[model samples]
Every structure is written in C-alpha cells, then in structure tokens.
Target chain A: MKTLSYFLILAFSGGEHAGGGSPLDVNPGLILWTVVTFIFLLLILKKLAWKPILKSLNDRENLIKESLEKAEVARKEAEKLIAENKLNMQKSEEEAQKIIEQSRELAEKLKMQILEDSKKTANKMLEDAKAEIERKNAEAFNKLKEQVADIAITAAEKILKENLDKAKQINIVDKYLNEINKN
Target chain B: MYTGQELIGADTLKQVAETAKKTDTSWIMHDVLDANEIDLTPFGIIHLPHLNLFGFDISITKHVVFMWIAMLILIFVLKKVAKSYKSSLIPKGVTNLTETLILFVRDEIAKPTIGKGYENFLPYLLTVFFFILTCNFLGLIPYGSTATGNISVTATLATLSFLVIQIGGIWKNGFFGYFKGLLPHGIPAWLIPIMFVVELLGLFTKPFALAIRLFANMTAGHIVILALIGLIFILHTYVVVPISIAFALFIFLLEILVALIQAYIFTMLSSLFIGMAVHQEH
Candidate 1:
C-alpha cells in the first residue's frame, strides 16, 4: 500500500512540474486521501452517530403516537359513560311521572265511591221518614171513625127512642152503609 | 481560487529566494493561473515532509490538511451529538444544530429522492452531505483551503458515488439486466447501438458533471472574491480599496451561500443517481 501510494504521488507531483505548474493539477495522493477519509467517516459515523440518533427519533415518534391513541380511547369511553348516565336519568324521570299519574287515578276512584255511599244513605233515611208519616196518618183516621160512629148512635137514641124497633134500626144502618159505598 | 491567493504567495517566495534581486511587483493573471505551490502568504512556507513511503510523494498538501481539519470538525461535532443521544432523545445546545441538519438531509434529501429503502443509503448520504458542507465551510474561515474546490477531491467523491450506483444496480438488476435497463423502449433496432453508446456516455457524464459542478462553484466563488480584493492592488490606489473591500465582503457573504448550496446539490444528485440505479426504470 505504501509503495503504491508513493509511486502514485511521484507521478502526480512529477507530472505537475512537467505540466508547467498549473493550479488545476490533479494529484493521485489527494484522491487517495479523500477516498480513505470519506470511507472512514462513513463507517465510523454510521455506527456511533446515526444509529442511536435515528433510533431515539423513531422511539419518540412511536411514544407520541401511542399516547395520542390512548387519549382518544379514553375520550370515547368518557363520552359513552356520559350517554349511559343521561339515559338512566331520563328513564327514572319517566317512571316517576307514571307513578304520579297512577296515584291520581286511584284517588279519583275513591272519591266517587264515598259520594255514592253517602247519597244512598240519605235516600234510605228519606224513605223511612215517609213510611212513618203514612202510618201516623192511618192511625189518626181510625180513631176519628170510632168517635163519629159513637156520636151518631147517641143522637139517634135521643131523637126517636120508641119510634123505630131494634131489628129495623140495624137494617136501616146496613142500608145507609150500602148507599155510602154505592156513592 | 486558492490559485489566485497562491499567486501572491508564490512570488513572495520567489522574491525572498532572490533577495539580492530588485523588488518583485504586481500579480499577473498568468501567475494566478499557474500557481501550484502551497499557499501561506502571511507566514513563510512551512516545509512539510516529502518522504517517499515507497515510490510516491507522500508529502501532504494544503488541501489535504484542510480535508483532515474538516473531517476532525465533523467527527467532533457528530460525536458530541452522539454522546447526547446516549443520555436523552431530545438534543440540547449545539447538538441541536447537528441533529437538525442530519434530519433535514434524511427527510429532505434521502427519503424523498431515494424513496423506498432509503435507510440503506442513509450513511453515504449523510456522510457526503456533512463532508462536503464541512469542507466548504472550512474554506470560508481564515487559513483554510477548500478541499472540495480541488478537482481531484471532487472527482474522488464522484467516483465513490459512481461505484455505489453501478454496484447497487448490479446487485438489484443483475449485471446484464442492469445494462439492458439503460436503453429506452420502443427504439428502432438500427438505433440501439447508437442509443446504447449515448446512454453509456450519459452515465459517465452525469457523475463527471457532478464533480465539475461542485469544483467549479467552490473555486469560482473564491476566485471572484479574490479578484474583487485584488482590484485595489491592480488599480494601485488606496482610494479604491474601500470599494474593493465592500464588493469583496458582499461576494464573501455570497460565497457562504454557494458553499452550502453546492454541498446540498452534490448530496441530492448522488441520492438521485442511486435511486435511478436501484429502481432502473429510466
């Protein structure tokens, strides 16, 4: 390698003087140096620098992506839970309204039952009073009839004591009763 | 270009060597074009060893020194970021800069351009990006030569990518199939030979252009900045120095932009070439 490079350099530098010392002189040594240095740099830097740097960048990107996805999942779950709670709250309110409507119906039925019972009692009392009044009226009428019959017999005795015989008087009273019935 | 800077530097060396001679004057375009020496204008040339390890000149050039410097800076910065990764996923302080640039290259350059199986080519993409960028930045700082501006350096880089493109193509499509995919469908039988030649030429020209584009961009920006600064010397007046400095400063700022852009273009094109080879639809 050293002999190869030594000869290469002599040819380049020797050729420079021969070519009248132009600044555009091409040297084999500089070319060798450049190639060697670049390859060295590429190999060394690839292992030491780029590997970890790119890895860390990739890792950071993955981390951020995972965190964002987790946050999105959490947000969706929270929204679902809120919706469930709202639905439950609405369902309970509907049940409460239904119960109130049912109780009102029961109260109305009870009021109607109480009114019917009171009205029936009042009608029965009025009927009982009427029956009692009718019985009293019948009693008074019977008593009056007895009194009138007695008075009539006394009057007949005083006016015509020997005029009419006992059998005839009974017959005349029967006839009067028949006439009253016919009229 | 370093050549422009080295022009002034070379003559100064020549002037010192012949101190008994009359003073040297003025930078010529020829000097700027022909300078092939080390550039250390402020400091006298420090003679680096030119030992023959075997038959070649094993002497280090200014560009190589700067290349090594760029490499060290990269290793230092990246290793520091690597250390932070060991502790935590989140980067801190200067490590953030390293990671941000790395991710930008991966996401913006490699991932979209290479599409599926981008990870396999990531190390090469990252290396080329940071390497070219660091070399370009080193040029902007004081006393640092642009290694990427050197034709040989850029060519070496292109050659590596070319190997990856071909080898990957062969690996994916088999040797014959890889070559077969080079030709477009529905071409007449008579045109296949001509088309194949053109396609083969295109394969080489693509990477060739990649090399030249980076070398030319980096070299051109520096040359423009140097020329702007050299204007004061050319005009031989203190009056124009302020204006020259102003323009030079503007171009220097612009060079900074060009350096980064050139590095990005090099890496982006490399990934695209690799993708073409791997997919082989074109």
Candidate 2:
C-alpha cells in the first residue's frame, strides 16, 4: 500500500510536469501497492476507528427524529385546543344574541301593556267626574225651591191682615209641600 | 536544501508549459508558497530507502517539517479524540463531535449494509472515512500535497475497501458460497458461464470506481485553484496581482467545500459497497 501511494505520487507529479502521454500511463507496481495498502488501512480502521464515529452519528440522527415527532404531536394538540376555543366562542356569541332578542321582546310587551292600562284608567276618571257634577247640581236646585215656598207663604199671610189659624196654616203648608214634593 | 527553486528550472518550466499546452493532465499551482522547492523530507524521515536515522539536522525544510507536524496532528488529534470514550459518560469536546460521526458510520453506513454483524466492520469504515477525509483536507492548506490527489493513495484506500468486501463476504458465506453467490439466481444453465464472467468482472469494477472518484475529486479542486491563480501569470505577468489573488482566494474557498464533499462521497460509496456485499438480495 505504501509503495502504491508513492508510485501514484510520482506518476501524478510526472504527469503534471510534462503532459504528452496518455492519462492512463499508470505504473502497475504502484496500483498493486495501492490496493494492498488500502486493504491494510481498511482492516486497521475497522478494528480501531469506525465503531465510535458511526455510533455517534446514529445517536444524533435518532435524537433528531424523536424531537421532530414530539414537536409534531405537540403542534397537533395546540391546533385542537385552538379549534375548541373557537367553537366555544361561536356558541357564546349565538347565545348572547338570543338573550338580547328575548329582552327586546319583553321590553316591547311591557310598553304595550302600560299604554293599554293608562287609557282604561283615564276613561274611568272622566266618567266619575261627570256623575259627581250631576249630583251637586240636583242638590242645589232642591234647596232653592224649598226657600221660595217658605218666602211666598209669609207674604200671603201679611196681605190678608188676619191672624191665620194654626191648623189651617199647617194644612195649607203640608198641602203645598206635598204638591211640591209630588211635582 | 530542497527549496521550491531547486526542483524547478527554466528547462523544466518550459517543458511544463509545453505539457500544459498539449495534454489533459496539466496541473496548476499559484505562488502561495514562496519557497524554492516542495520538499518530501518529513514524509521521508521515518520511512526512506531504509528506515534508519543517520544524522539529525536542525535546519530542515519548513514544508517538510510542516508535513510531519500535520501527520502528527492527524495522529494525536484522532488519538486524543478516541481517548475520551467511556461506557456511561457522554462524549465531550472533539471526542463528542467525532463520536457523532462515528455513530453515523456505524448505524447508517456500516450496520445497515453489513447487516446483523455490522459491528464487526464499524472500525474499518470509520477509519477509512476519517483517514481519507483528513488527507483530503490537509492538502487544501497552502503548499500542502493532496495525498488523495495521487492515484496510488486513492487506489490503496479503495483496495482496502475491496479487500474487506471480499474477505468479509468469503468469511461469512464460505469460499465456494462466495463464488456461487456472485452468479444471478435465475440465469439459464447455458448462460451461467457468461453471467459468471460478467459478475466476476463486476466485483473488480467496484473498487476501481472508488479509486477514480476520490482521486479525480481531490485532484480537480486543486487544479481549479491552481488554474485560477495561474491566470494572472498566463494572461499578464505584471500589474495583475490583486485580480489574481481575488480569484485565487475565491476558488480556494470553494475548494474547501469541495474537499468536504469529496470526502463524504468516498465514505458513502464505501459504505454502500459493504452493504451490497453483506446483503446478497441485490
């Protein structure tokens, strides 16, 4: 192997220096030596070097793959949580809209009920006022008629210039009261 | 003594220019290293024509010294990183960072392809990946040699992967079973011989593919940076320093990215090969 390496070095250097010959003008001895050396190196390395290096690389690869899988699963879980939150928000919004509509309807119903009640109350008050006025007028008229009859009786008694008998006066007054009462 | 100038001469430079004009294999190097020569003393220190230290010199070439330092850094850094391993504790610092890479190769690369007994192959795959990656990256430094830029280096690395596939397959499946396994299951009796030949050829082709891919990618990036820097010299020798530096730096940064990509591709392909061999279904 060493000889092969040396021959290759010489041949390559030669080719580099002067270049009229074919590229394949290789020395067989060097080729053989190279082959032998390569095999030797391979054996030594296999025994002493490769195991540790390969092990480290494999460990790194596995570590990377595992981390990637974990990240993927976590991302999926986060997405699911976000979706659930969005659905809940949509449901709440709909519920809030329903509640607002119900309250509006209630307010409208209450307003209409108050309007109807006030109209009924106002009609009742107007009817009571008319009945009260009629009662007062009738009382006043009856009292005036009684005062005029008393006054007319006193004046007739004075014009006759005679003392009227108590029984006949009583009888005339009763008869007049009865006639007024009847009328 | 081996400075960049010592290795290059007017005649050699002329030859280099001529080669560049004619062939597809020309390489470009910008004036990043203000040295006379690219030295190999550091790599040549321990292993030479003979592995012996005759005498030590204080004034060694900087590039050579730097190469030694780079290799030591590669070794020490890797060792230090590996030393941090324990059964229960979490890996820390450089160890932790590398541990991650190790695990990747074991689980994603070695284990998946090699199947039930993948643990056995983890060490090999991890080493190959790191070794090649380190070598490729080191070359990106200014005045550095791309070890993988050389076909021999790549071929050797490829060969090792090839050997693992072959030997491991043979061990698991048995010698006779290994050969028989190569043949397609549904081929007619007459066509079995032809199919067997094709299958045998296919086995060899996989490693060759590995070799070419790594070598080309590593070499290509350097060439691009070199070419970009060389543009100022080729187009106009004087008064183009700023423009050359800007383009060169831009490509140099791009080369860093390319360096990493090439390393990754090499490792991935090796793992795929192991997987193919271990799992006979395909």
* Per-residue lDDT value at A66 in model 2: 93
By TM-score, how accurate is candidate 1?
0.69
Error of 1 at A77 (Å): 3.0
| Per-residue alpha-carbon lDDT of candidate 1 for residues B1-282, written as tens digits (9 for 90 to 100) | 677656665665555535412322223222223233555668865555554556766557677777778888888888888788778877788888887888888899988887888888888888999999999988888756788988888999999999888887888889999999999988999999999999999989988999999988988877777777766765678999889899989989998999989989999999999889888875
Candidate 2 residues B30-71, lDDT tens each?
222212245445554232221123342212222233334444
Candidate 2 CA-lDDT value: 0.64
Q: Which residues of candidate 1, in runs, are more than 4 Å off?
A: A1-20, A85-183, B1-45
Give the distance in Å from residue B245's predicted Cα in candidate 1 to where it truly belongs.
2.6
Highest DockQ against the true fold, candidate: 1
Per-residue CA lDDT of model 2 for A57-106, tens digit only, reads: 46656878899999999999999999999999999999999999998899
Model 1's CAPRI class is: incorrect
Superposing all C-alpha atoms, what RMSD in Å does each candidate have to the true structure? 11.4, 11.3
